[model samples]
Structures are given as C-alpha cells and as structure tokens.
Target: MSRLPHRASRRQFLKLGLGAGAVLGLAAAGPDILAFASDVSDFIRGPAVPDVAPTQLSEHVWMIWSKDGFPTPENQGMMSNITFVVSEKGVVMLDPGGSVQIGEMALRMIRTVTDKPVVAIFNSHYHGDHWLGNHAFEDAYGKELPIYAHPLSKREIEGVQGSMWHSMMERWTNQATAGTRIVAPNRTVEHGAELDFGDVTLRVHHYGPAHTPGDIAIQVVEDELTHVGDVAMDRRIANMDDGTYVGTFRFYDELEKNASSRIWVPGHGHPSDQVLAWNRELFEGIYGNCLKAVEDGSTMEEAREMVLADPRVAGKAADTAGFESNIGKYVSIAYLEAEREAF
Candidate 1:
C-alpha cells in the first residue's frame, strides 16, 4: 500500500527528531504535540495512524480520520473517520464524530475547506463513536440538522442502546461527553433509497446486517465513492461483538457487486479497495475455518486455536497487537452462531 504524501512527511518529521531535541521540541509544542503524540502512540501500542487531515479523496469528497484505537479520554473520543462531500447545494457530512470536542474539530476542518453550510448529516450506524458528534453541530449552528440513518439505527439511538452509548461516552471521555446527548436521525432511509443533494446524489444501501444491525453504505453516484461505515477496516480486525461473521461475508459480496470499481471510505482506517478486500478475505477465511471446526465437533476454544494457527491470521495478530483479542472474540462468535444455526 502506498502511503499518502502528507503521512510520509509526518513520518519523516518524527523520525528526524528521535533524540533529546525531539523531546524538548515536543514539550515546547505543548497541547498540539500531546494530541499528535497520542495519535502516534496508537502505532506502538496498536496500529500506526497518520495525522488527521481533510484529505480530498475525489473532486468534492474529503475525509478526516481519527486515531486508531478505542475511544479514550487522552484521544478525546475521536476514533472514527469523519467525511464530508461538497456540493453546490451544501456540504453533506458522514459520521460527524464520537464526542462534542471531535465534532467541533470536524466543523472547524470543514469550514476551512468550504464556507457552505452542512445541510445534512448521516449516521451510517447506531454506534455512538460514529454519530454522538451531532451535539457539536447543533450547538454550533443553533439549529437542528437533518440527520439521516436506517430505521434500526434511529431505534437504537432512542432506546437502551442510546443510554448505553451515553454512559460509554462519559466513561471513555471523562468530562468531554458532558454536553453530548443522543441526537437521533430525524429522517430514515431504507435500502436502495437515493438522497439528492442537488449537485451530488447519494444512494443509500443497507446490505443486510454486518458490523451492526443498522449498517448502511452511502454510494456517491457521480463520484463512484462509497462510505461503508465499519463494514470493513484497513489493516485492522473489525469488532464483531455487535455483528455477525457470516453477515460480514454477505456484505462484502454486496460491496463487490456495487462498489468494486468505486473508492470505499471505511468508518475507520484509510480508504482503499485493497484494504476492503483484505478484510473480506480475512472474514471469509476465519469464518470458513470456524464452520469446519464446528462441523468437526470442536469446542469454541479448539475453533479459536485452529483459526489462529493459520499463518495469515497469526501475521495479522502480530501486526495489530490490540486486535488480538478481537480475533478470538470473532472466532467465538462465529462458532456460537454456527452451532445455533446447526441445531
């Protein structure tokens, strides 16, 4: 995978100042370095991530990624990719962010690129890490924005899931989530619905259930860009706690049919079809192995061992330290699902 020019430059900068000067310089930089350093720290402890920037993926499509890892106080609850599309009508945002602070940052970044108002927001899923940032938008504009999501996502945001996410925000972000509230999507979109934003048209497609029950992918019709929210990840193991392994494989097939030629912006990680394919292959292989183990009457622990024994799976675990646990969890989920289906 080719590195972005901006990311390569930041790597060079960090590499050049690896001594005492680096420490002193970072100290002088204060809060900015602390934030930047926290992002870098994800690499050593988990996955290396480039600094967030409003990078243009296509003509009018731009994205800003958050640090790689679970949301935490040090990172200010910014752990998902926030994207926006600029059209003559207005700016359309996807997954505002995880907290008010992150949302404010996204708003500032958007303003830096375009003066147009954000007319619509899309919560691709029900996860708070993707939409809790709605608080910042409402607080900033002093008006409610038209946030859209699948019916399941809207329901989850209004029920126990909403309260659970609110508690998670407070726990993970300390006081950063104080003013944050569950802002449910005002409008609901079903499968194969097209939303016209004047110059740009987004076709919303819900490819069954994958990452979450409400998972939906937005296809930018003109640009052939698809924002697949957490359905796939780049060089990282996806969370399956709220998802199903077989469902992910099904979603991958749908993505291949619809978005094979398009640029895919994931909920986390860099945008690339190769990464998407990698995730698909990972899920396919692991799920297949788990099914075989289940048919062979292996226990969950035995299925986990069999999947981990694969060189590809082992390599991924080595590359991503923090995700090692996710792999085990995924195998367990797959085994349990396969067992239930068999019975």
Candidate 2:
C-alpha cells in the first residue's frame, strides 16, 4: 500500500473509500472543520515570557514597562504597560499588558513586589493590547474577580472587539499571542466613580470620545498618578482611526480639570507629568494645522503638508515611534474632522 501525504488534499479522498457525494459534502464543510481543527491544535498555552521587573512610579503604583513601543515576534506581544497599585487591601491593576504570556510575566513581577492577590482590574478601553492579559489575572484570581470598563467598552468587547483584538494580536505578533482568549470586562464603571482600595483611592474619569467612544482614565488619588491608557500616549502617535482630534482636546481639558493628577502614565511609554503635555502639543500641531487648511479650503494633500511642517510635529518626528509611517494617515483623519467642524 502507498503512504498518504502528511496533509491529504480534498481530491485524494477517493482512495479512502469516500464516494463522490461524500467528498463534495466534505468539501462544503471543509473550511469550518479545518477552522475548528486549527483552533483545537492552537489551544495550547503560549510560551512563557521572561520577567521584565516592575518600576515603581509612585508609593502605591508600579508598572511592568515594555521597552518596545509596538508588538513584534521578538517582543512576543509585550507592548503595553501593566500597572498595578499595591494597597493594604490588595492590588488594583490597570491595563494588564497584551497577551497571556505578558500577563503571566506581570503576575511574576507583581509577586516580587507583594504577595497580595489582585483585587480588581480596570481596562482602559476596548483595545486588545491593553486588556487581553486579563486572561492571566482572571486565571490567577478566579472568574469572580471584578474586571471593570466603561459600559460602551464592555459592550463592544463582549460583542466583537474582543475576538477581533485576539485575532489581530496573533497576526501582528506572528502567532506569539496564540491561545489568548477574549476575557471582556465583567463589570461596568462610569465617569466620576471613586473606588477605594484601603490606603489607595482610584478615581475613574471618562470624558467623551477621544481614543475611542469609551476610554477610561484611572487616577490613583493618593499618588497623584493617572493612567491615561491610549487616550494620550507618550512619544507615539495615538491611533486616530477610532478617535477624534476635537474630542481628544476636550478629553484633555476635562481630565486635567477633574483628576488633578501630576504624573500621567501612558499605555506605551514612560510615565511623566509631561506625557499629556507632549501629546497635546503634537495633537495641536496636527489638528490645528488641519483646521487651518480646512478654513482655507485646502486639499487633503496640502493639509498633510501643513501638519508635517508644524514645529511641534517636526521636532518629534525623529524620536516618535511610527511617526513617519503613520503621520500621513493621521493627518488625513484630522483633515476630515476639521472639515466636519468647519461645515
């Protein structure tokens, strides 16, 4: 008897006693069957990540900072910062990294600082990179552990964004994030809700659509620190596809007024009081120029040129991550928003 190939083709079924109709039926169901099989095959846990150690940002807040600004196969999906607040009660986490491996790494780092279990989690937004690590925390702390998010964020995550982010992260990291599951926030948090965790108090602020329709900024009141998530990133151009230039400005104004935080922690970079200021200047340069171009009835290409020439954008171009590659697209988004505002 001849040996069959490792992966037998659909047309090779005749040799296995399958009739032509059976072969056709198999062909019809092949995609779904293969998908299920692939999912089962990929069900194993992702490779373990090395401990990156945590950096203390304040008396109560420490972060496992990812050196890389974006996910890659080499980094294994460790692109977002995992911030945890150690309190007398327990730990409160904000944006638990990006993958199961990263989350496990965060857990290892958290253990280094304190032995307390994670008492709560706050997902900054519906972005998968910021919250997919919820899998590790939930697995460590149990299913009943409350994961919080804005109502809109929770709805979108549980609806479609959860699976969408899981798939995107896998593709982006070349399967480094394989086996990560979609663990949406089980509870909802709204603006102005203050959560007390023993000596540490966290204030939640959501000031309209900025990065997304529901971006949550969590403030550690005692430490004067606020994790702004992707609403305002440091050194990197925030993705404006699901965001608005006008709304982001409004968010900044509202956040500064409401939170009174001195140090702003970002999802992708080092925490500093200047994080929001740096982002604000860059955004103002981009959006301010676009607004001017719209008022002058300039073309999108012309608007892009204006934004590129702005002093705020030009100065940061060399140091900002993905600036050259992403600026054109973001400028276009700003242009459209400017046009809308003009009309």
Candidate 3:
C-alpha cells in the first residue's frame, strides 16, 4: 500500500496489531458487534471542509472566524480561528487551524484576499486545535516552510503531546480530522524576538505560563493588534489543564505592561479591544472566590457556589460556550491552585 499524508499508513500499521489482539476479545461477539466496529472504521475518514471567507480585522491582519467553540463532527474540527498577516514580503499565519481540511479551506480563503504565498507560520501553543493544521500549510507551501513556536512547544509537539492531540482530535470529531498528521514547528521563537516582514513587524511575547508553558502571543506592531492565543479568550473559558490561575493573572499583567495593542485576537473567539479585560474579570471571579475559600478553610463545594454566584461569571454564563459542562472542572482547578498558594 502507498504511504499517505497524516500518517494514515502508520495508523493502519497500528490497527493491524490491535486487530490481532481483538481476535481474542471479540471471539464471543455476535455479528452485530462486528458490523458496528466496521462502521466505526469507515467513519474514521473525512473530507475537506467548505471554504470559509476571511474577515479583515486590521489593515493587514485577516481572520477566518470559527462559529463553533468546540469540535464536532458536523463542523469537522474547524473550531479554532485562523488568522494571518499580509505583508509586502508575504503572508504570516497565526494558528493555521485544527486540521488539514480546515487548513485547506483557509488557503482557499487566503487566495480571495491576497495572492501572496504564506511565508511563515506561528503556532500559539501545543494544543492540537491550534496547530494541527500545520500539516496542510507545510504540504502546500513545501517542507522548507518556516513554522515557528516556543522551544517548549516544539519539544512537546515532537513528543507525546503531538500524538496525544492527534488522537484526541480524531476522537472528539469522530475522526473528522482523520488525515491530519503531526507537523511540529520547525523554528522556535522566544519572548522579545521580533520578525520584521517588510511592511509589518511581529513581536513575540511569552510570559512564563498562562494557557500553556509554551504559549506565545504575536504582536503586530503596525496594526496595533495582538494575537493572544489561548492565554486570554474573548468570551470563553480558556482550558487550564496545563495552566494556572496565578500564572494567567501574571501573564495579563506582563502583557499589558509590555505590548499595548489596541485589539486582541484569541484562538477561539473574535478579535476585540476588551478581550483581555473580559477574560480577566471572568477568571478573577472564579479564582478569586476560590482563593478566599481556601483562606477561610471552606470546602470545594462552597468555593464552587461562590464562583457561580459571582456576577461576572454568572453574567456570561448564558453567552459563554461550554460553560455549564466545564465550569465545575475550572472551579476545581482554581480551588486546588488556591489551596497550594495558601499553603
């Protein structure tokens, strides 16, 4: 069989091994069970997404906004925004997207706005939703394309984090992101590093760990706009699995002190001047109460009640995506962090 992109060939190799093991496990299973398994295998394949037009946010920055906040088969894993900067030199991509299909769709949209090729790519973090689309861009642009990320992000993406995300996205989208292979960033960018692309310049900003240890925000100096990545979301709760509330607060402070971009672009939401403020208030509402609860020796349940009752958090509950299902976990994470700080 021919080797395919997105590691479909490698996946088949692994499936063969698993298939041998399944012989024993499914020895007693009826025909119905086998039929269901066959259906699942068929569902693993997905096609390209429909072309989505890019919306211009600044003079040079354009964004292909994703309507869905979470990955679903119907949306085919196009749950993250794809932003790019057009310059005299060429185009610079910020978080290409979540999968090959989404990336291809973004490429089609890019043609509508500008004919220049994508010169460089910058990944915000290690999350698959943010960078899995690297496969598409690298394929289109060639192997020599410069994909940039923080050192830690590059390491993580080359390690288990890369494979983990690839699998997780397949599971989340029911394999709608089937053909996406791991394409880690080839170049690394650190805080304070600046890339001058003729007409526009992008400055890198990484303040410890906010969304992830490797998260890097790119600042467009000419446009007076900054792509904050997952560090701060516009109206959504950022995933804190690899992050800390304290660190997030500190990141916000450091970002404000340094980069003063008029607009902030997030990975999951629209660009806005109030992006940082909106996320800060919501985080404080959740983490502040948790810290107070820890100081008072209150239980986790009590801390959750306080967070829910917080006007800042409650007000956004109706509009926030995945709020009801994820708030409990976020509150728990905050409570644990608060406890650690108190001690």
Candidate 4:
C-alpha cells in the first residue's frame, strides 16, 4: 500500500509514448511527476529503463522482464519475465518473453552471459507472458533443444487453433505470426523432476492445476535459487484467469521452506527469498476468502464481491479482478481440485 508518488497523468503518459522528448522531459520534472516513470522502470530493465538497474543478479543467474511500447505494448504485444541460468550443459532459460522481439532480446542477453547454446527451454506455464516467444528463440537456438512442461502444455501447443496461443501473443505481446506458433513439450512430468545442467542441478516441481494446469516451480538443486512461476505472485495480482485458486492452496502448501534458495525469482517482480512464508500466507488467505463466499451460497459474481470486500482482498481488488473476471471459470477450475465440494 505504500507506493511512490505517481509522475504522469494517464493523458500525459499517452502523449509521452508518442515520442522520447516528452518522456525525458517528464522524467526530469519533479519527484511526484516521476513516480509513474519510476514504477514502469521497476517493472522491467531494458530499453528505456533507468540507469540504476543492475543487469546481473549473479555470475550465472539473471532477473529479466521485457515490455515494449510500455509504447504499444500496454494494448498489444507482450510483457514478459524470464530467468537465465548458465550451467555446464549450456544456458537454460525459463519462460521466454511475450514476443519474438522480446524473446530475441532475452536470447541475445543470454549470449552476453555465455555463448553456450540454449539447451533447455522451460515453458513455465501455457501463458504467453511466460512462453509465447518460444518460436523466435527456438528457431534461433533450434526447436530440438527439448521443450519441457507439464503434459498438457504439449497438447495445447499441438491442438488446432491453440486458441490461447494466438490470443496471448497477439494481445499480450502484440506478436501474432506463424513463427510464434508453439511446439508441444518434449518432456513432461508430474510431481517434481530434477534437471541436471551438468555442473548445476535444477529441481522443477509440478503442482496440479494452479495458475495453469501445468504450473511448475523450479529451484536451483543446491544453490539459493527458486522460480515459482505464477504460483507465488507479487504485488501485481496473480493471474488466476486460468482457474487455479483451489489448487493454488495445495500448491502453496508444497513450498513450505526456502532454506535451499537465497534468491527467489517469481514469474514477475524482483527476486527475493522473503516471499516463501509470505506467499504461503497469501494463498491461504485467498483460498479462505473464496471458500467463505462459496459457503455463503454466493454466486461467482457475488463470491468475487465478497472476496473483494474482505479487508484482505479489498486492497488487492484491482489486481484480484485480473483473475476473477470469469468467476465461474475460476470456481469450476478450483472445484475440480477442491478437497470438498463448494457448490
């Protein structure tokens, strides 16, 4: 709730996006007037980002988020986040950005770290914010690099229309092209699997139906690194649009410790380990809010209102709606995984 002052008005932002001069001038104006710019900068580190961001998180890992148009991307293209780790096998990347352009930038950046081929590409989930840029990166690095995901991811990629695929790239990253067509997963596992990057071992944990049916959590086998795709979100509302609320509770419980990780990489936001316990608490709280609504015989819409009205949910209402828009969708999805029937 404690946020920095906002810099530009919406109208001012729109105008500044038209060119660079206005944006630069606006950034120089005053502290309050620069809040929005600072917020956007904190959102990602690339292109127009401030000079303060440290491009490297460590000798082998990176924290990355890609957005274009921040420009036209607000309405189209993609806003993506990625994590890169260099292992003796090669550089293994988790989740490509929203578009090929963004993905390409990520790839190039990875090259900056090491010339090793991108041996493994992990699609954190089916979402574009996480995986749409697969094509560009795959073509450059070779699709045979072996895509990894939950079984459903491969099915979604190969299915006709692959409806989610097209819409996500087009709307989120604004990149809708044949090259963006996704390739199904080559490796699929349930529960958890460990990937050995020669010198480094990575543990990928799959929790059923949270965020997406294929939601998985990755942790550096022995180091202090963990990637909790969308299961553990930041101040930015978690994207439950895919129907993971009920399962998210179970998923949250699985991550009971963070002793193994010194740095936590969320699907978005800066990496930190402090979120382990906090994320667990947040999920429990969200699940409780939704369960109470279900107990009250509230309709999905009413359930949303009830959840939003709770002090726990009130502050996050705006972010919560990002996932609650299709209340019925979430309930149906969560119901499938709920321990007890809510309806």
In model 4, what lDDT does residue 311 have?
62
lDDT score, candidate 4, position 42: 36
Positional deviation of residue 1's Cα in model 3 after best superposition, in angstroms: 7.4
Error of 4 at 1 (Å): 61
Error in Å for residue 240 of model 1 = 1.1
lDDT of 2: 0.86
lDDT of 3 at 152: 97
What are the per-residue Cα lDDT tens digits for candidate 3 across 87-184?
99999999998887788888899999999999999999999899999988998989999999999999999998987888788778766777676799
> For candidate 2, lDDT tens digit of each residue in 1-343?
2333447543343346543222233534577654543433243345678899899999999998878887888889888888999998999899998888888889999999999989999999998999999988888989999999999999989988877777788768766776676788999999999998889989999989999999999999999999999999888888889899899999999989988888999998889999989999999999999999999989999989888888999999999998988999999999999989999
- Model 3 is weakest, by summed lDDT over 10 consecutive residues, at 18-27
- Candidate with the larger lDDT of 2 and 3: 3
lDDT by residue for model 4 (42-143), tens: 332222221112156665677665332121444234444578788888988788765555566677677666788888888777765577567667778675
- Count clashes in each candidate, considering only residues at least 3 apart in sequence or on different chains: 0, 0, 0, 9
* Each model's lDDT: 0.76, 0.86, 0.87, 0.59
Error of 3 at 54 (Å): 0.4
**Candidate 2 to native Cα RMSD, angstroms:** 6.2
The best-first sequence of candidates by lDDT reads 3, 2, 1, 4
Best by lDDT: 3
